[model samples]
Each structure stands twice: as C-alpha cells, then as structure tokens.
Target chain A: MIGDAFTLVLLDPMINFLVILNNIFFGSFGLALIAFTVIIRLITFPLTRRQLHQSRAMQTVQPRMAEINKKYSDPKRRQEEMMKLYREAGVNPLGCLGPMLLQFPILIALFYAIRQTLPESPEALEALSAHLYQWTYIQHAVPINEFFLGIDLKLAPNEASSYLSPAWLFVVLVGATTWLQTKTTVTTVTDERARAQQQMMAYMMPIMFAFFALSFPTGVSLYWTINSLIQIGFNIVTYGLPALKIEPLLKSPAPAMAPALAARSAQPQSVAQPAPEPRTPNGPGRSKRQNRRRRPE
Target chain B: MNNPRFFAVGLLLALFVVTSAACGKIRQPEGWASPAVSDSTAYFFADKDRFVAVDLDSAKAVADPKSTTGATLQPLLWQFPSNDQKDQDAYSFKAVYTQPVRDGDTFFMASYDGGLYRINAPDGRGERIATQADIKGKIVAGPAVAGEYLVFGTTEGHLYVVNKNNGQLPVGWGKTGKDLGKGIWAPPLVRNDTIIVATMAGEVRAFGLDGAEQWQKRFTASGAVADLALLGGDSIFVPTLDRKVYILDAATGAQKGKEFVAEDWVWSTPAFAGGVAYFGDFSGKVYALDITTMETKWKPYDAGHRVKATPVLIDGVLVLADRGPVVHFIDAANGTGLNAVPVVNAGTVRAGLTAAGGKAYIATTKGRLFVADPVKRSVVEVGVGGGK
Candidate 1:
C-alpha cells in the first residue's frame, strides 16, 4: 500500500518536491504550496475527465429522462421508472462525486504540509527555517517575505495574521482563480435555472475558500490558486475542445409537444432497450405478481 | 502528535540536555557550583542537560552506576530533563553545569540551553515557579533565591530579578515577559535588602528588591565566577576564573580584601568558619582564607582532588563531599582535617551538605541520596530520597 502507483503517482513525489521547495525558499513557503497544487491537479486529471464525461452523458439522456417523468407523473411511479431507465442506460446518478471523495485526504495532507512551511512562534519555526534544504534561489525564506504581497504566511489569524493586516492581494488572486475553475466546470448549461445555480456556486464557493485562505498561511492560498489555474487549463483542454453541435439552440420552436418528440427520438426507442432476459411464470400467482409489478420510473 | 506536544517535548528535551551537561560537571565551566536543598530533595545540575533531584535518603539511583552523561556524572537522580526555547538557534550551545539554590520550598537553577527552572524543593515535581528570564547569554551562575525573588547574572553583564512565583516565565523574562539583562551564570546572594549578582563580563551589580539597580562595578580581571558568598559584617566574597577571590564591601561596593593564589581557578563557594573561609580551585586544590588578616589559613584543603561541593559549617566542623572518595570533615575553627569517610559509591558529588534533623543529607552524581549519621558512616534509609 505504501509503495503503490497511486501513492507514488499522487502523494510521495509531491511531498518530496514540497520539502525541497520549503528548504531552498527560506523566506517564503508560498512556492512550495503552489507546487503542491500543480502536483495534485496532475494526479487527479483522469478522474476529473471521467467526471466530465459522466456529466456529458447525463446531459445527452436528459430528454429521455423527461419522457419517463411525464409517463409516470405520479411521484412513486416516477421514482420506479427512473430507476429502470437508469439501469437500462447504465448510469449511476452519484458516480460523478467519486473524484471529490478521493481528493479529501490529499487536500488535508497538503493543507497541513504547507502550514508547516511557515509557522507561528519565532522559536518553533527556527529549526524548520534552518532545515531549509530546497528553494535556494531565495536569499532568506525564514520570514517568507510579505506573504506573497500582504499575507503574513506564518500566522493563523487567531494568533498573528488578522483581518486588520489582511493579505488582500493574495486573497483576491485566490478568489479569482477559484471562480474561474468553478465557472469552467459548471458552464456547460442550456437551461437558465441551471445556469443561475452554477453562477451562485461559482461566486459563493470561491468567496468561502478565499475567506478561509486569508486567515491561513499564504502557502495554502498559493496552493489553491496555482492548483485552480492548473485545473482550469486541464478543463479548458478537455471540455473546450469540442465545438457546439449547433443549429438546435438558434431556432427556439414553441411546439407544445416538442419535448415529447425530443424524448421519443432520444431513447433507443422500442425494442433496442429492455432486454428479454427471462419470462417464467411457474408459481401459482407468478403471472399476476409480474403483471402487478410497479413500472420503471 | 499535535503542535504543543511537539513544541513542549522539544523544549523539555532541550532543557534536559542543557541541565544534564551543566549539572554533569558538578560545577560551571567558568565558576563554582553548588546545590541547595529544602525538603529531603536536592536540586542541582546532573550536567548541562537537566536540573535533577534525588531523595538524599535513598540508595536506589546509585545501584548500577553508569557515566553515560557525556560529561563526568550520569545517573537518573543526577540526570536532567532538557531545555526550553532560545532566540538565536544555538546549534552548538551546551548547558554549563550549575548547582541549585533554595528559598523556602523552591529550588532555582538555569539550564545552559536557556531555562531557569523552579522545581519543588521536596519532590522536584516541576512546579511552575519562575527562575527563568529570557536574556541572550549563557547562565552559568545558579540562581540565588532571595525571599520571593531570584537574583542571578548571565554571560552578558546584566543581573535579573525573576518573580517569586513565575509571574513571567518560560521565556525567562520578568513577570511581564520582557528581556531585562545580559543574563547570569552565577547565583546571587541576598543580604538584608540588596541582591549581589555577577556576570562573565566581570561586572557585578547590586539590585534592590524592586529590580532597580543600586550600584554596578567592574573588575579588571573579568572572566567568570564560580560562586558568591556574603562575608560577615556586610562584605561579598567572590571566586573568579583568574585564580583569586575578591572580598568587597557590601555597602559602598568597595574592594576590601583579596587572598588565595591558586594555580587554577577557584570556583566553588567557600565554607565560612570561625573567622575563616575554605574553598577549592578547578585544578583540585582547596584553600582556606583567614577572614581577619586576609591571608592564607593553616590548611588549604583536606581532600586530594578539587572541592566542588560548598562546605557546610556544622558545630565547628566544615563538612563537605568533593571530587574524591571521602567526605572531608575539617575543624571550622582551625582548618584541621578531622576525618574523611567513604560515601555510598564512587560517583562524584553534585550537591553540598543540607543538615536537617540529626543527619547530613547528601546527593551524589551517582544519583544516590544518603541520609547518613556523619559519625556512624553507615547508610540511613536506602533509596529514600525525593525528586523523581
């Protein structure tokens, strides 16, 4: 487990790089953090791509889902038929959340690692500063000069770094990058409601992350910002590559049964779906039970 | 696992190494060393690494004695914990061995690594008393307990008055936690209302009880002092690294008398007896100075090696253990060697005589606390001391 490809591909090399950067850059731990973000994004690229693919699949099946909802308008019937439709399409509704769950520990470990780059207490950090074996380009990384333009990367707000002396530049930069990343991911939308929801998240989540980043060390913010840019680049390459299959959005036809026709055309239609796996009515009431079974929602 | 634990362990370990090294030698590198006792426990440096206390009545730590101290002495009771934090990272700093001094129930001492500790007098149960005040210098002089205050000089030429009960501590500053001086290595002596302290810079200062300077004086041959003892009728007798002792008037800060011409430095605080003083030098020679004539007394020292322990004047008998096998007993009135008896084991002695009840309590570098009837030469209670 310790020497697996996932560990090597994800954690170890990055940690080594972080330690190296931390040593040479005595005056600042920010670079070490940025390096960590880049490493994490690189490692998680495949998963991010998979999630994006799943999202596109969900979008392609939307019309069929709408037809199923219309056929079983009753709540209980709709739920059942939805499950059947999902099974036929071979899509797990929550499969897209896998990447986020996998990245939790990485996020935590990175947070803790960079926090050590610049620590509080002049005494406690002395050893760590002296132990700087990487980042030799910087003259002195001990004080991690100006917190990359205002953040006192050593303090944790409750201690020394406070809102009074907030690192505004770093905070704003982090917020901007985060906003950009969120926008790129959730912008593949057709409906105004989904777009509005995406807009709210794009603004809210970035602001939240930025607020937390300001109170913490700049090393962490540096990680988040640089990581966001890397992810944004990756996302643009993956999602922005394909142009729109257009002419559909240009003419908004107000046909009353347009949704019905779209749904009818979207499905594999009649026989292609619903496999003929088995048909055995051997029990005394087997035929009656099969007939009474709830339809797929 | 957490920040504070790691920080504390680091601090404690530093204190330990310093206390062990300083306490190890049973004397400071530059001056004299002594240990003070209050409640059956003796507090002194095992070496520079840690401040240690052994139940003077116990024979436990003395068994299977080992000299792993990296210095001279190494035993658990003689073993020290570690040191705390420092300003400039002292990559090469080591604790200067120091003896402990007492005031009431508290024992005060400093680790060469930068920790002025106030441990319980009886059990050495790390009480939160303040003896440390953060000043950038080596503390070789043990702290002199004055009432509720402690007076000591640092490697830098500054004297400090620490709070009675850790009003400001850990960082080794005043109650408000501020740097006050160059820091002391020698413990201070309390006389009436004044505290007499000395530094390695050869500057001595008399500070009032309120931490204000009363007077400051400089000595020509400034180096390091081993011990400071107040002479009778208001005079301070100081032993120096320059192989001499200077007697100064307590009131006017005037040099009154000077005697003793040892080949090496005389650092231990000499024992005073019927108008005479008995001391030892680092080269292992004990000398006695006549208090009246300021001349050499009849016998310099009764032992064969250096006298590290400060002699205690008991019923005209100057009783002490030093660098040799036997505890020397001299006539305080005449400088005559009365008797020299063998102790528990062969380890060097770390502390002096603290006479309590009818027995003499002695702590050795072997970590054995002995409660012996000076006349019997037999062990009292084996493994019966405190400060675990």
Candidate 2:
C-alpha cells in the first residue's frame, strides 16, 4: 500500500512536474521538490489536525490511569477501574491511540511515497504506472538528476553506493529532536510502576527514530525533520507548555482537591513504606540530619 | 493543557511547509552548445580561428554539383587563422559546424569552449558572429541545418533553433531554455519543412521553424533514440537503445508500430534506400528491414563492434563504413557484403566520413585523413584533421 500511494501519488507526480518545471526553469530539481512537497502538505491537512487532537487527549489520560491503578490494586480490577476512569473523563484511551494507529497506513503510504520519488527502486516504472496520478508533465519526465542540493536521490545509503554526507546529520537531528519531544512531555509519576515505564520509553523512542532516519532519502529526512519540527511546535503549544504548567494548575481554585491529595499521601504506600519523601539519590542524609536534631539539641 | 486547541498548531505547521514549497521559483539552465558537422569544408566553429578547408574540386563526387546527390555537397575549404597555433587550439573547442545553408556563402557553427558562430563562404573570410548562449562541455551531437535556421541539441538536453541569416541569437524554441529532459546526440531530421529531434530518454518531438512543437511521442520501449529516419506523412523510423525501431507519426507523435531488430543493441543510424531501412548492430550484422512489414528482408554480418556510420546511398547501391579498416559495399537488394574498402590502419571514423570528389574522405582516431578513390584502389593522406 505504501508502494502503491508513492508510485501513484508522490514520486510520480513530483517527477513529472519537476521535469516540466525543469524544462520551464531549465532543470532545477530543488525548486521542483520544494514546490511538490507543499502541494502534498496542503492536501493532507485535515488528517494531520485530527491526529494532533488525539495525541493531546492521550497525554491527558496518563495521570488518570495512575489514579485508577492505585485505587484498585488488583490487576484485573485496576483495568476495570481504568475503564471507569476513562468513562468519567469522557476520553477514549483508544482515542489517543486511534490517531497513532491511523498513521500506520498513511505512514506506509508516505514511505512508499518517498521511495517512489526516490530513485534506484529497480522496478520504478512499473510502480510508477500503478500509483502515479496520470496527469500532465509525465509526457517528458525522466528519473531526476543526482545534483539536488548535493544529495543523490538515485542512491540509497548502503555499501552498494556509499554513505551520504547528510546521513549522519539526519540521524543526529532525529535522535536529538526525538529525545526533546519525548523529554518535554512530563508524564506525572503517581507511582513507581508508571515512572519505570515512562523512563524506559524516554530512552527507547529516540533510539528507534534515530535508526529510521539513517537509511532514508535526504529528502525524506528533510520531510521528517520538518514534520518533527512541526510536531515540536505543536508540542510546545499544547503539551510542552501545558506539561510545564502542571505545577501551577495543581494550585487550582479547588483547594478541596488538594485535601484529597494530602489524604492520599498520608496513607502509607506499603508496609515496606520506604517509598515516600520523594525517592532520591541523597538517600538518608536528610533523615540523619533530622535524627541529629532529634538528639536533644 | 486539556483544551484541544493544540491541534490548530500542527495544521498550521503543515500549512507553512506547503506554502513555502509551493511558492519558490526555479533558476535558469547553466549553458548551451550546438553541434558540429565535418563535411566537405571541414566546417566548424565558423567565426573563430584556424580550420582546414578541403579542395572539393579535387574530391569529384562533389565537384559536379548538378546531381540530386551532390546538391547537399560542398567543398571542404581549409581556413587557417592568422595565428595558426592559437586558432588550432580554438578550433579544437568547436561546438557546432552545421551543413552549408547556401552554395558558397553561409553555414552554422559553435565551439564547446567558446560560443555559437555563423561564418562566411569558402576563401576563409571575415570574423565570426557570436550567440548569447555560452556554449560549454562535450557537444556530442547536432548542428543539424534546416532552411534558414541552425537546429541543434545541447549537452543540457535542449534543442535550439538560431537564425543563420542574422547573428546566431536564439530565434525560436520548444523548451523554455533547458530540461527538454534528455540530451539529443543523434543529429535532428528536417523533412518536408518540419524539424525533428530525438532524446536520450526515447522521446521524439517535432517543431516548426519558429519553435512550435508539432507533436511529441514517447517510445515506451525505446528508452533512448539511437537514430531517426523520416518516412513521409510525418512518420519517422527511430532505432532506439531499447532494441526496437519505433515508427511514429510526426504530426501526432503516435506510435505506428515498433519493429524489434537486434537482440543486443543497435547504434548505427538506419539507412533508407530503395524503400528499405538498413542498420547494423553490436553483432556487426546489417539488417535490411522492410519499413511496411517491420520484418527483416536481409541480414549481413561484418564481424565488428558497431556499424555506426550511416550507409551512403549511390545509384541504388548501398555503401557503409564500419569500425573496420574496411568500407562495405553491400548489395541493396540482399544484405550481402559485395566488396570491402580496407583502411590499412583503422579506427572508428574519428570524424564523420564525407564521400565527395569521387573519393571517400576517412578520418581515423590515429589522426590520419585518407582520401580513397575506389576505381584507382588508392588512399592518400590528404590532410590530418586530428590534433598533434
């Protein structure tokens, strides 16, 4: 399906229009790609908006989930409690996941789309025929030249050709930005179990995105980097700023809610209750200081 | 944070990327070059310095200009620049040397290192007129002459038609300036007043003298056009690197039918003689194909790398030059090699062979120019057109 959309839509039209534009502009593939990318972005705007709302809703539910887990200590009952929690919050946990899941098909479509615009696929003509929109400009389209901003679209980074100069840069950008995007979303740690899961994801997600950025076309990396920056902007606007505002929001108009939080903290976490006092690397230094003061000063 | 207003931002980001890409304009083509034709006068880079002009009155096939065959023939007049050495260096950079447009007055030319040029008649007279385009790089093909214009394709994949009468300013064109998408190496065809050029990407487009494209045809199987032969009614037979010769309607750019010939490759320009198209291949076999049936009527082998030279048609007999030290005299009726004219030390014709003055002028890679008169069975070194 990815191959289908790419062939029919992305690579095919871009190749055709770029050639015509090259004919008109006299062979500038860079301008061609830039112009073509804009056309695609405009067409897919509605889907992108829907996806953003879903991500924001997903972020909102994480703390509520931690609340449900604490109230129902049994795993089976906790899952039921979490469902009840979701029902009360009027948000589908799946609603948060739904947009991400929806991206699978579009991602494949995008992957194929990028690959289609990319050269060296060996069976591109057949693929192009299947997926490319039959329109004008194809009458004179050829495989694009390799001089677009010094990146060879015809070459994939492998021992077959050689590593691209931009590959490392792209990998670094992907890893760094992915780390930032994930790091900025402050998942409230209501307990040890949730904190462990969050920490695992914090390290894992960036590494996964970094590996993906390495072998892709410089154009795709450009797109992803641009997309990531857009996501970052969205993160800042919605999740990023708001996540930081968590402390301030906690000082809500409702001090009544704060009494509940104080009551919850008052209850002992376990008989092994070494959990409170904000677990830290400083261990018992403060506790030892308190004991000294308790030594009848 | 719980307010869903955050999504308005992702939509905005998409809008930004799209808008920037959609709006930016493109830059212009780098440079342009015209083709050079080595004919009777060693004509090329017309306005520049030194060039060898052959004595056509001595090369008999062209001396008598009354014949239908000799109408296109003219003397190879050698021009020596006032500064011979520098002129020779300048001549080496020739970009275009078109066939003579008038009997003795004008022809088209350009230099790969220089620019476009339109020079005077024989006697090697006057300074060269230049074109606005800075001709650059390895100009492999073209400078095809049609009517009053010098038609040619560039390394930049553009086809240009410049005025031969006026200074070689680009008069009319099909492509805006470049990316006609594929470079054209084979010289374009001018038949019944229409100008035809083929692309490296198997596209055949025809245009009027003023640059209006008559039709455009893409050969699906002919990835690259190797040669084109005009067959009236806007139909042209094109031999392609794709191993097929496609017949296209020049007016509509529609494929009439494709004739599959060689199994490996066909590089030689197809010859139209006695209503048949003859071309040789990597296998060195010359196939005589019936244009109508798309079937091979005859096949003759030369056991060479390529039969790249166009077959010279004379009095219903077909003669072709090969990669050999030999010239082939093939029976037009059957694809049999009737005689072979050997070039004691041979190379792919270092330059195109011009048979005039009742002799075949052969230039080889070894830098030897031979004048062979078959009836006498003798070849003498008339001049060396190659560099020292």
Candidate 3:
C-alpha cells in the first residue's frame, strides 16, 4: 500500500516528466536531467526562499542574540530570551531546515527515477515495466540511450569511460556548486563557536556530496550537479555575490576574530557593530548609502 | 537555527539518504544468456558484438590430442563482423543477449540493435537480415527459427516474423500487424504453427503464422514472465517475476492447476526429467515439482545465491549453476547433493548449463568455459578463442 502511494505521488510523476523531457530533448538523458532540475527548482523556489529568509532573519537578529547571551547570566533565561527574540523578529528557528527536509522525498524519487530509466539488468528492466504507465510515448522510449557526451549515464563518473572522462567534469561541478550553495544558505552567526561549526558544515557537506558523485552513476551525479547549480543560482539571486565570495572563507576566521581585536583596540560596541548582516545588505535596516560604503569591502 | 526541530529535519534527511542508498536495487547485467551446443560446435555470446562459435571437436582435441578435429574443427571458427572490422562500442552498437539458434546450416541470432543475422554455421560469412529500421525497436530475445520463417519479439512490444533467408519482414508482422502491448524479454516458443510469446506485462499470448492473435492469458497479480517450459506434451510451465510458477494448457491457454509459489522470482528456465520439473528462484532455492500434480517432489535445494541459469540434467545428475562462482550437482530423484560439496570453482555462472554428447558445458561471466563430465566428475577449462 505504501509502495503504491509512493509510486502515485512521487515516483510516477517524476518518471513520466523525465521520459517526456527525454523525448522532447532528442533523447539526451543529460539534457533531460538538466531540464528536470530546472523545473523542480522553479517549483520549489518558494520553499527555498522561505528558508533563505529565515537564515537572513537569523543574521539580522544576531546582535540582539549576542546581547541576550551577555545579559543573561542564567542559561535557562538566555534560552527563553532567545526564543522571545525570535518570536519578536517573526522568525521560525526551524524554517531554515524545512526546505531541506522537504527535499528528501524528491531526491529519493529522482534516485529511483534514474535507476528505473537506465536499468542495468534484465530483471530490473522487466520489473520497471510495471512501474511505467501505459502510454505509447513511454513504451517507445524503453532501453533509453545511456550515452550522453561520451559518458555512460548508467555508470559512475569515474566508471563511465575511464580516468579524466567527461564524468570527472561533472564531479568537479557538483563539488563547486554544492560548496557555493552551502556557503549562501548558511547564516553567518555572530557567536564564534557557532560560526566555526557552520563553516565546517559548509565545507564538509560539499566534499561529502562530491565524494558520492564520484561513486554514484553519472546520471545521478548529473542530477546533483544540475540541482546544485540551480540552488546556487537561487542563492545568488537572494543573497547577492558577496555571500558567494570565497575570500571570506579564505580569510580563516578573520570575521570571527574581528570583535576580539576590536575589544582590545577600542570599545566592545564597535566590535559587535562592524559585521552587521553581510547576507542581507539591501534590507530595510541597512541604508543604501551604508551599502555603497560596504560594497568596496 | 540550531533547535530540536532543526536537528529533527536533519536527522530525517540523513535517514532518507541512508534508506535510499540501502534500498537501491542492483539488476542482472545484460547478455548473460547460456550457450546453445549443436552436434559439433558450441555457440555462445562472447560479448555483445561477438557471438563465438567454439569448435567442440577442436576444444576436445586440445584436451585429448588422440581425439581428432572433424571437418567442423576450426578452433576459432567464425564470429560476426569478421576479423578486420573494428568492433563497435557496445553502448552505441547494441549487444547480443539472445542465444544463437542453429537452423540447418545457418546460425540465427538477434542483437540489441534490432538486427537479425543469419550466419553460415561452418564459415563466418553472414549478412544483416534485419535492422532496427525494419523492426523499429531493440531485439531483446533471440530469434525462434520455425520452418522457413524466423520470429522474434522486440522491446517495443512488437513481434516481427521475417524470412530467415532474406531478413525482410513478412507482410503485416510488426507493430502495425500484431503487438503483445508490452515488451517481450523472453524468446517466443514456436510449436504447432503457433507462436507462444510472453510479455513483461505478465501476459502470455499466442499468434498464428499469418500474424493473427489466437489466445491470451493474463496474470494480474503476477510479474513479468521470465521463461517458459513445456510439460506433459501440452502444459506450459511459466516462471514469472512474481515468484510463482503458473502451469497453463498450451492448446487453449487455460490454467492447469494452482500456481506453485516460491520464495522469490523464478527467473531461470526450469529443466524437466522423469515426470518432474526442476527450477530455481532468485532467492537461490532450487525446487522439484511433479508436473502432473503440481506438488513438490522433495525439499527445495539451496544454492545460497541467485540461480538465473537453467538447471541441466546430465547422467541422472541435475547441475544447477548460480549467479555466483559455484555450480551444484544434485540427484534428480531425491534432491540430494550428488557430490560431497558443490563445485565452488566455476566462477559466476549466470548463463545456464548446456549438456550435449555426454558432457555438460558451463559458461562463466569471466568468459571461461568449463566442460564437466558428470560420469567422470571432472571439469576442464577451454581456451578463449573467436574474438578479442
């Protein structure tokens, strides 16, 4: 019963859409995957935007958050104050993860879709017949072309041809795009400890995804690369180019260490106010004149 | 952002990723069909592009020099595309999964490219009898050479009947003519002027030579029919993907008895002997059933791996090869192991065992052929030949 519902709700639609895309795009599965990623990202843009807004909101309230941490000597009161602060700012702490959580079902369905479209075994093909709808367009598209751009989409990027194959380019793209997406999505926290943890995740998640891309089928890696690129594009539109800049990452905790240096050189107030919401510069609080001055930085 | 709900969503995403990876299915690779042995030669798919003809006499002569190489002994014999042609990439050029069938002096086989070739058995000379343009889809099943015409089904759910001599389709024998409405993975069983073809949609249909439908049987709950075996001169034993064997009457397409349920799918062709049918399932258990009564003859034989190969009988011993690197020999009468321990050295025998001239030939996925004698309890490996 669960299988039937899953097929009806997610797998069937994904498979049909992919097949139709393949048919429209001259049977190039690679191109079809890119088109599908674009469609999925477009459909999920609102959810992703909500998550981005929450992350930017969290950044906007970081100063008040740090002030609460400093004022409340008691840990319990600090926690209560933080929740109250979030409520006043109209930010849901869980909103940043809601879009990611919703993406799981779609990701899994796409995995099954790629496997079903390019089944490697005779038994798999036979089993796939049942999942496919009774349509002539789909029936004629059986035994889909696994080759695109000289890579067997059914095999891993490394396994497709050999070393330095076209799949390698996909591996690199998946890594680069995933890194950029992660960079943009992560809120720049004012707390040094929390920022360190978020920065670690930003780098670690991309490397892990890239490793999987090197191991999974090229078709799957193509999906990841395209999906990541779409997310990165979405992030750039929402957060702008500075959030995507690798220079901040290369500075090695310079933003995190800035306040400490300022506390020693000047006042603690000057230290807390310098890095005010880098992710959302054009928002209501940060004036256009101030944004122009910060643009050169 | 770090809260119970945030961590809860992350946990769910991680759980889904692990679950998806764990539940990912691995299918049987294409082109693992067993070899067909004629009187003097053993024909098998060496790869997709090359269907090799191993001279049995030549192979035996090398093992025992006292044995003579007959007129058919041409060591490497003949392969498709000849020796000079650069073998096309298997991805671009469809590979041959169908076992080669010998009809008179010619060997007939179909490829993934939907081309049927009629090669002169003795020499390597052959011609492309049918192309994908003629059939309109890939040919997953081998050709069933019945009389002067050759019939085969395609992945496009269309059946094509063409002249074995010319490769041209007979008038009205394609998608426009008659189709099974689903892909046909197994070769059609031609008997009594009727072509019996099973579809991946869990359907069995028969068609006349004139491209007319005769009868159809549908198993709504059952999966695709993987293979068919004839029993009691009239009953058709169907091994299906739904893990059940359905016995149907050949003449009228009626159910003969209750389905024989298995632990998993019965994907391999079942072997019959002494009023009993022996087959294995994807779950690695072999079974013997009384064809007349639909009852188990003995306890299921366990091979501990997927048995996709059709079990063969040689000298009262049932040889069952598996998807792994082992082959088990059991006594056909009681389903007892004939040898103390099964031969665990054959190396991934996905193709079924071929028995001929008092010897059983087993082809491994590693491209090595092991010729075993059930009587002597000996197996000898043959050298690679035909194509590189």
lDDT, candidate 3, residue A289? 60
Error of 1 at A284 (Å): 99
Model 1 ranges off by over 4 Å: A1-297, B1-109, B120-133, B156-158, B169-183, B209-212, B216-223, B342-345, B371-373, B377-388
Off by over 4 Å in 2: A1-297, B1-50, B56-77, B80-104, B126-128, B134-138, B168-178, B216-221, B231-234, B350-352, B357-359, B372-388
Candidate 3: which pairs clash?
B325-B348
Output the lDDT of residue B218, model 2.
Answer: 42
Query: Per-residue lDDT tens digits of candidate 2, residues B131-168?
Result: 55444333444565676666667644777666666645
What's the lDDT of the predicted structure labeled candidate 3?
A: 0.70
Index of the highest-lDDT prediction = 3
In terms of docking quality, how is candidate 1 classified?
incorrect
lDDT of 2 by residue, A242-280 (tens): 645633222112112234333444676453122333423
On residues B144-183, what C-alpha lDDT tens digit does candidate 1 reach at each position? 6666666555544455666667544422336432233333
TM-score of chain B of 1: 0.67
Better of 1 and 3 by lDDT: 3
Going through the candidates in order, their DockQ values are 0.01, 0.04, 0.16
